[model samples]
Target: MEQERDFTELSMMSKTRWNDNELRYFQHALSQLLPYVNPEGLTILHEINKEMQNRD
Candidate 1:
Protein backbone atom coordinates (compact mmCIF):
# COMPACT_ATOMS: atom_id res chain seq x y z
CA MET A 1 0.00 0.00 0.00
CA GLU A 2 2.77 2.39 0.90
CA GLN A 3 4.73 1.42 -2.18
CA GLU A 4 1.72 2.01 -4.35
CA ARG A 5 1.23 5.47 -2.91
CA ASP A 6 4.92 6.21 -3.45
CA PHE A 7 4.76 5.18 -7.09
CA THR A 8 1.61 7.21 -7.63
CA GLU A 9 3.19 10.21 -5.93
CA LEU A 10 6.31 9.86 -8.05
CA SER A 11 4.18 9.99 -11.16
CA MET A 12 2.68 13.22 -9.89
CA MET A 13 6.09 14.81 -9.35
CA SER A 14 7.26 14.10 -12.87
CA LYS A 15 4.66 16.52 -14.21
CA THR A 16 5.97 19.49 -12.29
CA ARG A 17 9.13 20.21 -14.30
CA TRP A 18 8.08 18.89 -17.68
CA ASN A 19 9.18 20.77 -20.80
CA ASP A 20 7.46 20.28 -24.18
CA ASN A 21 8.96 16.89 -24.84
CA GLU A 22 8.87 16.00 -21.18
CA LEU A 23 5.30 17.24 -20.94
CA ARG A 24 4.29 14.73 -23.59
CA TYR A 25 5.91 11.99 -21.55
CA PHE A 26 4.44 13.34 -18.36
CA GLN A 27 0.98 13.37 -19.90
CA HIS A 28 1.43 9.85 -21.17
CA ALA A 29 2.54 8.67 -17.76
CA LEU A 30 -0.15 10.62 -15.98
CA SER A 31 -2.88 9.13 -18.16
CA GLN A 32 -2.19 5.84 -16.43
CA LEU A 33 -2.60 7.50 -13.05
CA LEU A 34 -5.79 9.48 -13.79
CA PRO A 35 -8.06 6.49 -13.25
CA TYR A 36 -6.80 6.41 -9.68
CA VAL A 37 -6.42 10.15 -9.09
CA ASN A 38 -8.18 13.38 -9.92
CA PRO A 39 -6.58 16.56 -11.29
CA GLU A 40 -6.96 18.54 -8.05
CA GLY A 41 -5.54 15.73 -5.92
CA LEU A 42 -2.73 15.21 -8.39
CA THR A 43 -1.89 18.90 -8.28
CA ILE A 44 -1.44 18.76 -4.52
CA LEU A 45 0.73 15.65 -4.71
CA HIS A 46 2.61 17.08 -7.70
CA GLU A 47 3.67 20.20 -5.83
CA ILE A 48 4.85 18.33 -2.75
CA ASN A 49 8.40 17.76 -3.89
CA LYS A 50 8.84 21.23 -5.34
CA GLU A 51 7.47 22.90 -2.26
CA MET A 52 9.78 20.84 -0.05
CA GLN A 53 12.76 21.66 -2.24
CA ASN A 54 12.07 25.37 -2.15
CA ARG A 55 12.10 25.27 1.61
CA ASP A 56 15.68 24.05 1.64
Candidate 2:
Protein backbone atom coordinates (compact mmCIF):
# COMPACT_ATOMS: atom_id res chain seq x y z
CA MET A 1 0.00 0.00 0.00
CA GLU A 2 1.04 3.60 -0.59
CA GLN A 3 0.80 4.37 3.08
CA GLU A 4 3.23 1.61 3.94
CA ARG A 5 5.64 2.76 1.27
CA ASP A 6 5.40 6.32 2.46
CA PHE A 7 6.18 5.34 6.03
CA THR A 8 9.05 3.16 4.88
CA GLU A 9 10.59 6.05 3.00
CA LEU A 10 10.09 8.44 5.86
CA SER A 11 11.60 5.97 8.32
CA MET A 12 14.70 5.64 6.17
CA MET A 13 15.46 9.33 6.39
CA SER A 14 18.71 10.15 8.19
CA LYS A 15 17.47 13.41 9.66
CA THR A 16 13.89 13.60 10.77
CA ARG A 17 12.56 16.83 12.24
CA TRP A 18 9.81 15.20 14.24
CA ASN A 19 9.28 16.41 17.77
CA ASP A 20 8.93 14.12 20.80
CA ASN A 21 5.20 13.69 20.38
CA GLU A 22 5.52 13.05 16.65
CA LEU A 23 8.27 10.52 17.23
CA ARG A 24 6.15 8.75 19.79
CA TYR A 25 3.24 8.64 17.40
CA PHE A 26 5.37 7.32 14.57
CA GLN A 27 6.87 4.70 16.85
CA HIS A 28 3.42 3.56 17.91
CA ALA A 29 2.16 3.50 14.35
CA LEU A 30 5.11 1.44 13.23
CA SER A 31 4.63 -0.96 16.11
CA GLN A 32 0.99 -1.47 15.21
CA LEU A 33 1.98 -2.00 11.57
CA LEU A 34 4.47 -4.77 12.32
CA PRO A 35 1.99 -7.61 12.00
CA TYR A 36 1.05 -6.64 8.46
CA VAL A 37 4.32 -5.20 7.22
CA ASN A 38 7.29 -6.72 5.43
CA PRO A 39 10.64 -7.76 6.91
CA GLU A 40 12.08 -4.36 6.09
CA GLY A 41 9.59 -2.89 8.44
CA LEU A 42 11.54 -4.47 11.27
CA THR A 43 14.61 -2.63 10.08
CA ILE A 44 12.68 0.63 10.07
CA LEU A 45 11.55 -0.05 13.61
CA HIS A 46 15.15 -0.61 14.62
CA GLU A 47 16.16 2.66 13.02
CA ILE A 48 13.39 4.49 14.83
CA ASN A 49 14.54 2.92 18.10
CA LYS A 50 18.06 4.11 17.43
CA GLU A 51 16.77 7.61 16.76
CA MET A 52 14.89 7.57 20.04
CA GLN A 53 18.01 6.42 21.85
CA ASN A 54 20.12 9.08 20.17
CA ARG A 55 17.72 11.73 21.32
CA ASP A 56 17.82 10.57 24.90
Candidate 3:
Protein backbone atom coordinates (compact mmCIF):
# COMPACT_ATOMS: atom_id res chain seq x y z
CA MET A 1 0.00 0.00 0.00
CA GLU A 2 1.08 3.54 -0.62
CA GLN A 3 1.53 5.96 2.26
CA GLU A 4 0.01 9.43 2.24
CA ARG A 5 2.31 12.41 2.36
CA ASP A 6 1.94 14.63 5.42
CA PHE A 7 -0.42 17.52 4.68
CA THR A 8 0.84 20.13 7.15
CA GLU A 9 4.25 20.08 5.58
CA LEU A 10 2.75 19.98 2.14
CA SER A 11 0.53 23.05 2.62
CA MET A 12 3.44 25.02 4.07
CA MET A 13 4.94 25.09 0.59
CA SER A 14 1.87 26.65 -1.02
CA LYS A 15 2.16 30.29 -2.05
CA THR A 16 -0.78 32.68 -2.24
CA ARG A 17 -1.26 36.29 -3.24
CA TRP A 18 -2.24 38.76 -0.50
CA ASN A 19 -5.96 38.21 -0.97
CA ASP A 20 -5.70 34.44 -0.44
CA ASN A 21 -3.18 34.48 2.37
CA GLU A 22 -5.77 33.73 5.04
CA LEU A 23 -7.10 30.77 3.08
CA ARG A 24 -3.61 29.37 2.78
CA TYR A 25 -3.03 29.75 6.49
CA PHE A 26 -6.41 28.17 7.27
CA GLN A 27 -5.67 25.19 5.04
CA HIS A 28 -2.32 24.72 6.71
CA ALA A 29 -3.87 24.89 10.16
CA LEU A 30 -6.65 22.51 9.21
CA SER A 31 -4.14 20.01 7.86
CA GLN A 32 -2.34 19.91 11.17
CA LEU A 33 -5.62 19.57 13.03
CA LEU A 34 -6.95 16.71 10.89
CA PRO A 35 -5.29 13.98 12.92
CA TYR A 36 -7.10 15.13 16.05
CA VAL A 37 -10.49 15.81 14.47
CA ASN A 38 -11.62 12.19 14.56
CA PRO A 39 -10.65 9.35 16.81
CA GLU A 40 -10.30 7.13 13.74
CA GLY A 41 -7.83 9.65 12.33
CA LEU A 42 -7.75 9.31 8.52
CA THR A 43 -9.59 6.01 8.09
CA ILE A 44 -13.03 7.63 8.31
CA LEU A 45 -12.86 9.17 4.84
CA HIS A 46 -11.69 5.93 3.22
CA GLU A 47 -14.46 3.86 4.79
CA ILE A 48 -17.09 6.29 3.54
CA ASN A 49 -15.86 6.82 -0.04
CA LYS A 50 -17.28 3.59 -1.40
CA GLU A 51 -20.64 4.13 0.25
CA MET A 52 -20.76 7.72 -1.05
CA GLN A 53 -20.51 6.56 -4.66
CA ASN A 54 -23.48 4.27 -4.16
CA ARG A 55 -25.53 7.08 -2.61
CA ASP A 56 -25.17 9.64 -5.42
Assess each prediction's global lDDT (C-alpha) against the native: 0.51, 0.67, 0.43
- The digit string of per-residue lDDT tens for model 1 on 1-56 reads 22223344555554444334444444456556777878875775456445445545
After superposition, candidate 1 runs with Cα above 4 Å error: 1-18, 41-56
Best by TM-score: 2
* lDDT for each residue of candidate 3 in 1-56, tens digit (9 for 90 to 100): 54444545533453222123333444455457786767643443333343344444
**C-alpha-based local distance difference test score of model 1:** 0.51
Tens digit of lDDT per residue, candidate 2, span 1-56?
22233444555566355456656777898799888878877776777778788899
TM-score of each: 0.34, 0.61, 0.32
All models, RMSD in angstroms: 9.3, 5.9, 13.0
Candidate 2 RMSD computed on C-alpha atoms after optimal superposition onto the true structure? 5.9
* Model 3 ranges with Cα > 4 A deviation: 1-18, 38-56
Which whole-number lDDT from 0 to 100 does residue 43 have in model 2?
Answer: 74
Candidate 1, residue 36: how far the Cα is off, in Å:
1.0
* lDDT of model 2 at position 16: 55
Return model 1's CA RMSD, one decimal.
9.3
What pairs collide in candidate 3? none
